[model samples]
Target chain A: MRMKRLACCLAIAAFTLPATASAQGLLENPADLIWVSVSAALVFFMQAGFALLEGGFVRTKNTVNVIMKNYADLCVGVLAFWALGFGLMFGDNPSGWIGVTHFVPGDLTGGEAGFMVFQMMFAATAATIVSGAVAERMRFAAYAIGAVAVTGVIYPVYGSWVWGSAFEGSGWLSERGFIDFAGSTVVHSIGGWCALAAAIVLGPRLGRFGPKGEVRNIPGHSLPSVALGVFILWLGWFGFNGGSTLAADASIGKVLLNTNLAAAAGVVGTMILLTALRRPVLITSSVNGALAGLVAITAGCGSMEPVFAVLTGFIAAPIAVFGGDLLLKLRVDDVVGAIPVHGFCGAWGTLAAGLFLDEGLFQPGVITTQLLGIGAAFLWAFPLAWLCFAGINVVLKVRAESIHEQRGLDFTEHSEVGYPEFQTDLPHAGRND
Target chain B: MAAHDNARYSRERAVISEVLGSKLDAAGVQSALDLWDRKFAGQKSVPLIEFVNEIEAVQALEARERHELRLALYKGMIQAAAGPTTTAARATTRATSPTRPRVEFKGTPAEIVFLKIVQYYGEQLRVLGPAVMQQFLSELRAALEERRMPGMLGDAMATVAMRGAVPDGVQWGNTARMHMLAQGLYVAACKAAGPVQADRILLGAVNQAKQLEAAKVFAPSQFL
Candidate 1:
């Protein structure tokens, strides 16, 4: 009865708020929904971009492995999220620190199915981000297991605390109310951090470093693939940042503007820094910079002005490139910089929301509260993720195939190659290196 | 046999190093041991060794960022011995006119097959190249911008017009430069089209790419 009363109140509020507040911006709030949806389509399409980009970066032998990881992510991520993740993430709780038990189709307490769908997509995205970092060498089964944990447990339990109603007003749960108007922390970091953890465990790829820890450059197989993938991802950010508004309103235009500016800034940031380092515009670095900019702006997109957004992306670029190197120093072998861009920058994005926003930065000290929200999120998700990984590692005994790793997983596991014809020109196409 | 060979090689390397160093000094012997440790442990030298052969100087812009970058580099240089001149850079079909000289010329096998590819695809005389410039109106270009660059070769070249099977699953930027390169090669092949020895080798390479695509060894670009 209490829950139903909550439901009734929500339904009434949902109808009343949008209707009453419906004012006409040039883009209009309601029309923003279409724009936001289009943005989502781009983000959804990024899976392919990621597949090709990563495929091109690694040895061509691993190209099949690259596509497989992406394929598994979309297929499995949606399933886990839909089946149970939504219920735990948005459902009511005592402190919103963690959600209580609920699973299966009819079990969602959020009552509104739309919110669940949004959460589901966020969960899917967070889950997919890990595939890139773990890319070439991880066992297929282990990666699948990681996907399940992210969508079902790691993402939702943390998501609920900040978003859990503005419930129980201003406690650890409510005060910080994790102001992720979108999911820099909830989605990007969860994937990013998990990538960090997985990379640490997996160790570096065989030829990644030279003697005495000098890094060797492994040029991608196709610059065109990388370029195409980056363009695809750039198209996706419109949805990634825009959809966070969760309403079809004036916020849409601001979201779109901020998302675009930040991405451009990311490119600018990476290009400048890289040029300074005397490094050429690496397809990998520039592409990763674009992604970092996207991740940095995600939490603050709805609230920030354009200039601030450019700064946010610019800051994220160095953080991404260097942070990737930092992970390597820490002996983490993140194949795709997932942790740096998503995990490290996600955390920064959420916190930057407090530091950067205009007068509107989180409805007042909701900024401080947002920090608390992020803390709570860390508290909620980290241990759970660690345990989930521990469990998967124990059960699956997921180790990279020595022969397969040397041979490349594509032909070994999947019986496929990304470029079969390119083999003819090269002397040792099929011969295992 | 190879395993034994590798082990034998390792042993020889170790002996050669030790013998060479023993005549130097105690410091040299210690240094040799250190070198051995690194080699056996699979560590590379501290300073990086640059590969001189591998550097490719293909200066171009993001095809998505702008056009013309791809075309000027590819068509003006590799294909026509010149990338598209700025005036000719607008994406347009070349083989669209049936009367637009189907002139086939002959060269080596590599050249022979290039013409065949152009012969099969009517108007894409300048579509596929290394740089991402506006070239021929390609099924590939439209698909790339939409972020649905195909993984399979067939899907990449498949269009509403005269479709020929392009089997080389070499996924690169769908830039105008790349398109022009493809066109230049194919046209050269077409000009060489009368029965020739070079024809078989060129066709063989194209066929391999196609076979690989058929085998599902290749996937489309992750543009979308």
Candidate 2:
């Protein structure tokens, strides 16, 4: 009788104490902590999605090399972000331009620590985006150095201007009410703009352009892998947008619904456009359309109504297709259409967030603030990334040698091949070597 | 002795059948096979060298087609001889038989080198497909006209079009002209198939030339 009574009292107290503590604001609700932590894990799993997508985008000969770069993005990105990026991004920022305190934080409250893990995944994602853009030809060491630059300085510093108030002071853009609910501009566009600069500096892969300046098609090796990767990313986006709420609240349901609707709309839009244009509905382009939709909806997923989310995603398909064509016209060889899917579409999504707000759609001041944030991302990321790439080129020769390229980076850099039995041109017997 | 002759005849006929099948359509292949049987009806065995010579004189085939057919015949005969044999036995058979014909190039060292290089490029272009080969020939004609070597262009076109079988009464050009022609072929291969393949093709040609007695003194790297 005594044991049963004590057990009953303990169960009652366990339930009541959390409610009291949460109400008093002394401790975080356990449900909120679990949600954010799970979401952080989902975001981290996106690194594997990136690896598969990039690996599928390149030739079989360079697949291993591309996967290695993705691994570099996660491993190097995590360390760099933990050491310098977190403090620079979330530290006290009275200047409204950059963070001023908290480098390599050891002591933190539970909520701050969870936020740090979530943000660390975002930084790693920003670094990994460049890997696909510079696939097949960029030197491995140069890419690792580039990852460090992105995670350590470029992404965090730019991130500070928008999301710097996690610990103490506010960001200039946030102060101006620039609405980026889930970092369409902060994470995706920053990464995309950095990708653009790196690609421009690195130049195109060998034989990408013909002698007559014609654009040749260098299709990726595996469409199935690309499709699987997009699906994984789509799954991860749920946590990405939902977890940004920082609590297990009623709003997560609507945010996730918006996200899924946009992705579906993106696929439909791409298929319809391709059929109307008399182009074959390519699986590769369709998956990319799905990614474009996901990227576009990310900024506005929380604030926009479901209908506008569909519109945002549907519009992003054409933007991605046309943006890819424009890059080809400009002689830019983006391997996996990273520039269109992330950079251009991200900017559009940022704008859509302001334009499609449920409260008051298209408020002039909100639109202007969003525009400033978009332009600031481009202005800040591209030039600095370009200079970094050029500097790496001058110092360490960022481009692989013609001999190494002919032999494939897998054999030359890592001394392994993805599909050895299928390959007839072993690295040893080639004349260029 | 009678059983050995029967086995040899079967091997020779099978080799000829396999070679002709790749080069001709169904009806044409059958017709060629019938002609082979008729020609070698009473013979104990058709020597591969003699059969190749007979193929060279076949009036129904184009010169390039005959050349391709002869190359295929030689490869098939070697494989047939080595079939189901131990490595040592295959090596002994190859050493003792007259099936392996040594190609004798009748030209100065540079001319021999030129012929070997052109032949190698032609073979590689054929492997890359007919469209690539046609494009290369078109490019070569334009390049030759730009260099104002119309007479040389005609000879070059004839030699390449005929799979490097030089026309009678033609002059073997100097090393410089050969180098220029070789470089043109390299460029065309690179444009069609990319540099990696072009380099491999050129290296194979150089190695082929190095094996020839007459062209052994010439530097292979210069052609590349």
Candidate 3:
């Protein structure tokens, strides 16, 4: 009887041992935790890039104003995302329309916290894009309020439709095989659409058009700052796309390579196009081309082959250039070309993700899914943001008064000036008086 | 008494006609002159202030036209007080007079007229802020220098830049140069403030100079 009992215990041990080993293998890796944390840090650093890019693009009088908006939006965005956006985006999605649990995200696992932090940066990115489009004219307080609405409601609700299954039930869009690896449509295009709405409601800057409706060039103040900003964004994008894998794996090598190839292809394509059009190869347009490429590849970087990524980015140049001209013809003043580089290129990138899928190129069903997702993003983000801005305008006035605009927002809003030494002729330096 | 009244009426009518004739027809001019005469016919001397008040009360004339007429009348009265010297002779006297040591500006009529407009706008902008006036003059000088203006025009702009104002007794003889300078000022004001404020400043300056013969010849709209 004792020998039989011992044999039974050994049999039970044999059955459980492999199961325990498999469970241990499935546990989170320390390397993944470290990589994700570092990537989140890199993504956060993109805010500085945004600040420099926007500040350089505005006039000297409005430089400080743009920087302030960039800085403030991050602060407002992070807190709003932390309070509500993370949960709405990644919580239990019983209805598949919105997440219903995990508000404020307490007592989370290490992996969950890292994910929340990483996604928090993306929310901030979406919030900050509007600052550049509405630069030189938007009221600071109204912008802060708009940032809250974006991160808390607009961005997260849409994000849940694509990425909600991270914790629980799957989103309908993701279930339909709509693949957005790192959010060309989910992040950049949503922000771009919001920017479009805000810019439309705010109207063009004074004298941007002539009596007969001719377009005028409003050159940015600093090319060096713009160049520096693009370089920083390029560096940050490696982490942006690579880190989306959520693991320290060999796939990151392919993702980073594709991202870099796309950006390079973007610059080459822009230079070639400019030469073809008999226009000067301008530094600002070149940098903007690089950004457009980065935006375009963000959706498909994980799924696209290197050559297809290059094609995706190359095509984005004309979209950006002509998209800008289209806005001018439509009388929409998108300062710094945010609508073109982010919005139009982002949509193109989403479509490219479907067309350039590594599994098979130009799958009609996949392309249709991508088109639906892209259309949904514009429909969801634009009108919602327009209503928000119009409501904000009614309540708090989103556009600055013409008198205050003439004095520059830096002086009128912040009691500061970017170049005080050059302003020696001005009374009291930074003071409005 | 009737002869003296006729002489006063003829002198007043000439000044009024010169100012209002372009804006008003002959019937309107006659009505304005008759209204002035009827208002002050019994008085031994009519005060300039009362005369201006009566012009301001006229319903048919625009406020701008009334201001022009008032300015023209004041100039006529001053010329009459200074005796029968022609404008050229008075200008020569001022230039050569020992009591007033400052030299007179000897540019062409257009140049002098444009300079006066510049000074007028400059003064008006100064009322807004000294910095505004400085920025306007600086932009004007920059525009002048950008054209590589030669001779007296360049020298005049340099002096204006140095003084941070349009200096007295200097000639900017070329009408084109003056037009460029005015355009520069408008552009600068647009940058410093905005197009609306810039337009307001230009309109005010042009209205002040509308009665001048040279202003009609140069036409502020050309530069604008």
Of the true interface contacts, what fraction does each candidate have? Answer: 0.00, 0.05, 0.07
lDDT by residue for model 1 over B45-161, one digit each (tens)? 211112101111111112221133223222322322222333233222221232332334243333333334444443333132211111222323433344443423223333211
Model 2, range A1-433, lDDT digits (tens) per residue?
A: 9878865654454234221111122117778888989999999888878888989988777898999999988889999998888867876666676665566777766776778888899999889989999998999999999999999999998899898846566789989988888889999999999999999998887656655666767777898899899888888888888888888889999999999999998899999999999999999889999989999999999999999999999999999999999998877878888889999999999999999999999899989999999999999999999999999999999899655665578877898888877754442432343
Model 2, which residues run further than 4 Å from truth?
A1-27, A424-433, B1-224
**Segments in model 1 whose C-alpha atoms lie over 4 Å from true places:** A1-39, A100-102, A106-114, A165-174, A360-367, A378-383, A424-433, B1-224
Give per-residue lDDT, candidate 3, residue A123.
Answer: 95
Every model's DockQ: 0.01, 0.05, 0.06
Comparing 1 with 3 on lDDT, the higher-scoring candidate is 3
lDDT of 2 by residue, B1-224 (tens): 47655555556556665566454333334444566677854353446545644442232244565678778776765655545323213222211231212334457777777777777776676666545565566565555565566555444443443334555555657777766666666655655665556657866887777777766677554554
lDDT of each: 0.57, 0.76, 0.75
Provide the global lDDT of candidate 3 against the true structure.
0.75
| Candidate 2 chain B: 10-residue stretch with minimal lDDT | B91-100
Model 1: lDDT of residue A41: 65
Please give, for residues A1-433, the per-residue lDDT of candidate 3 as tens digits. Answer: 9878765654453233221111122116878877888988988989889888988988777899999998888999999998888767876665676765666656666777787889999999998899999998899999999999999989998999998846666677988999889889888999999999999989887656643566656777787998898899899998888888888999999999989999998888999999999999998889889999999999999998999999999999999989988999998988889999999999999999999999999999999999999999999999999999999999999998654555568888898999998854332346543
